[model samples]
Target: MKLSKNFTNPLAANNPVIVQILGICSALAVTVKMEPALVMGLSVTFVCAFSNLIMSLLRNGVPSRIRIIVQLVVIATLVIVVDQFLRAYMYDVSKQLSVYVGLIITNCIVMGRVEAFALGNKPWDAFVDGVANGLGYAFILVLVAFFRELFGSGELFGIEILGDWYTPNALMLFPPMALIIIGCIIWVHRTINKDLQEK
Candidate 1:
């Protein structure tokens, strides 16, 4: 039951992107297109899952004072692996992602799970939590990208979806529009999960 909660809650109740509002930077930056958003999401998921497992495995040996530093090192190493893999096989998407791929080290979702859950949980449980959080974050990114790409360019993954008769809305491509979309998501999320609403 606990493991299921760890796997399920982040999808909505504790979503790192919309509920906890972590990793918003990448959510805004890489979500302009579906392909990049999907890549970015997978990158984050890999880093978060492994980082959590590693940290959980090392939790007992690491000195408390240096834990944060160690966590950064672990996360950075994983991010580097993901970045290089993308550069090697998906050069175009890598270029589209730019520094944001490296920036996964600093994504709140990665470090946040390490500090909050991995430090104390068993390795399997921590891994599941990390995967859940990563997926939750990805869900929002893809959803936002779906709207942005469709409306902004009348395409998905750069392939034309809407007929040319539909004029693309330029504003949908802008960062501010991503913010508004996120705001609407949060509003709707809070409305549905009354527990998240203010008392």
Candidate 2:
């Protein structure tokens, strides 16, 4: 149950990037390419999961007044570690993501999970919360990457999808298109998950 906890939350209701819209800025900015988006997703998942785990371990000792600062410290440390690892190993993807890797420190999703769920839960539950949110964000990031790459570049993971006659639209490569796609996704998702529709 401890391990499973780290894997499920992001798949459902409390998904950091989706239901809460926690990291849309980065989600939109880096999702134009599938490879870069995948790197970002994996990096975030690592940072979020470790941050939650560490934060949960320290939950008992941190004074209420200093909890936020402490959480940031933990998150920043993990983000930097992940960034350096990416630079050393996946240098190509790192170049594409550029400063966005460092910006993960400011990502509300990571900090939100640490503060909201990790702070109150045991280490196991916090790990699960982090994983779930990571998967949740990954799910949408991949989804957005799917459409963006397929149409913007006539490819998915860089393979042609539209065949010979199809012309890729340059607009789809721009960051603003992510907002339109995400809006449509929300529209369709709300239509399907009508229970979430604003009454």
Candidate 3:
């Protein structure tokens, strides 16, 4: 039951993006298109999951004074691995992502989970929490990208979908539009999950 909650909570009630608003920068930056957004999401999920596991495994022996430094090293190492993997196999998408991939190292969701949850939990539980939080962030990214790419460019993944008859809305391509969409998402989400609303 505890493990299941760890895995499920972040997906909705405790979503890292919509509820906690933790990873809004990447969500806005990469969600210009579905392809990059999806890639970014997967990359984060992998890094978050493994970083938590590794940090949790090391939590015992690491000195409290150096805990943040150690956690950063672990997170940075994973970000490097992901960055290289993207460069090696997915060069085009990687080029599109640019430095945002490396920026994952500083993502609050990743570091926050390592400090907040992984430091206390067993490795397996920590891993699940990481995966759940990562997915929560990813879910918002992909959804925002879907609308932006479809309406902004009349395309999804670079293949035109809306056809020539449908005029692409240039405003949708901007960061402000992403924020508006995210705002709408937050409004609807809070409406359904009323507990998230301010008392």
**Clash pairs (backbone) in predicted model 3:** none
Give a tens-digit lDDT track for model 3, residues 91-155: 99999999999999989999999999999999999999999999999889999999999999999
Least well predicted 10-residue stretch by lDDT in candidate 1: 13-22
TM-score of 3: 0.98
Best-first order by lDDT: 3, 1, 2
Span of ten consecutive residues with least summed lDDT in model 3: 19-28
Residue 177 error for model 1, in Å? 0.4
Better of 2 and 3 by lDDT: 3
Model 1 C-alpha lDDT per residue in residues 1-199, reported as the tens digit of each score:
9889889999989888888888999899998999999999988989999999999999999999999999999999999999989999999999999999999988988999999999999999999998988889889999999999999999999999999699999999999999999999999999999999988
> Deviation in angstroms for 41 in model 3?
0.5
Q: Comparing 1 and 2 by lDDT, which wins?
A: 1
* Residue 71 C-alpha lDDT in model 2: 88
Clashing residue pairs in candidate 2 (N, C-alpha, C atoms within 3 angstroms): 5-128, 6-128, 10-132, 10-133
Task: Identify the candidate with maximal lDDT.
Answer: 3
For candidate 1, list the clashing residue pairs, or say none.
Answer: none
Please say which candidate is ahead in TM-score: 1 or 2: 1
**lDDT values of the candidates?**
0.94, 0.85, 0.95
Model 2 — TM-score against the truth? 0.93
